[model samples]
Target: MEYEKQTEHKHHHVGYGTLILIWVALIALTSITVTIAGISLGSYTLFVALFIAAIKSSLVINIFMHIKFDEPIFKVFLIVSGFTLIVIFILTFSDFIYRG
Candidate 1:
């Protein structure tokens, strides 16, 4: 028997359990990082904040934005944007580091 595919745009209910867990984990981690930043960590505090922010952004993009299920073109756009951001950061840091 040949099975016919549905042509209409059907909204499949994806289980939110996994997504909830991931979001909760990200929130917990971010809270802990912020709590730690409150302490006297000196210069390392900046690095820690940046790291936490990056992780949170990644979670938002991959899970909430549904980038993981997106097409290759979207992935390529993400990669290009990420690389561009990295290049800009590097250049800015280079200027700061070299400033007399």
Candidate 2:
């Protein structure tokens, strides 16, 4: 019996230009977060910083980590993990606030 060889599927390649663009955007977001930290936004400062950080993380994970091309289950797991993290952060913050 002869065994058939399976053909490999070609994966999508991200161009250097696309990577550079993402890097630039990440840098810009970092700068904006730092600038925001300097100004007095009261309690909103943490929220703004975390929001920017989340955007940066999403870009890094989806583009750099190739999560965008991954399977649907991976995306679903990512969402679930993110939701769990948010819940944990909220609980921790709430506990700290209540304790103080």
Candidate 3:
């Protein structure tokens, strides 16, 4: 019974106003991304777009997915997965760079 108590899940409640704000922020970021795409910043354009996309994804994961309120293990798993993806991206880009 004691172990059960320690392992119990938490209930995270988000307000309607907070959700609305997040939605607005997401819309604004999307608009900015679209506008940036048309501006043509040269090589820096891709990096800028990726940075903005990363922010948008994080907000979706933390708020919409409710990952922020979950257990620490889940958070660890997310970090590990993200790290793996980054490593894959790096390796792929490196190979592309060397092939040319």
Candidate 4:
């Protein structure tokens, strides 16, 4: 009985190997992006920085928040929330950007 319980627990233990690999890869990519940002990219530096930040945020949400494994309804809610946030952000930024 003890051996069977141990086996069940072992089977239920989720491995972090894949998550670690994803984290390391994302870290490397972020480092590369930061390095690239150091060079002169004309007027696109801000956009590039924002893009990198978005990628990093996506990795955190998918992994730490477990959004990737969530149900369809949860995914829909997440997607809607993300889009709503983006819309609000864009609206606010536009107001500031066009203040002139």
Question: Pairs clashing in candidate 2?
Answer: none
Each model's TM-score?
A: 0.76, 0.83, 0.84, 0.68
Per-residue lDDT of candidate 3, residues 1-100 (tens digit): 7645543443236667878998999999999999999997987898899899989999999888877877788899999999998899789878976885
lDDT of each: 0.75, 0.85, 0.84, 0.76
Each model's total of backbone clashes: 0, 0, 0, 0
- For model 1, how does the per-residue alpha-carbon lDDT over 1-100 read when each residue is reduced to its tens digit? 1212221111132248867888898989888897987898887787788888888888888767767655578889999999999899889988976999
Backbone clash pairs for candidate 1 read none
Worst 10 residues of 1 by lDDT: 1-10
Q: What is the lDDT of residue 14 in candidate 3?
A: 67
lDDT, candidate 4, equals 0.76
In angstroms, give how far residue 27 of model 4 lies from its true place: 1.3
RMSD of 2: 4.4
Error of 4 at 17 (Å): 2.4
- Residue range 1-100, candidate 2, lDDT tens digits: 1212211121346778889999999999999998998999988888899999999999999988877866678899999999999999999889876895
TM-score of 2: 0.83
Each candidate: RMSD: 4.8, 4.4, 2.9, 5.8
What range of 10 consecutive residues in model 4 has the weakest lDDT sum? Answer: 6-15
Clashing pairs in 3: none
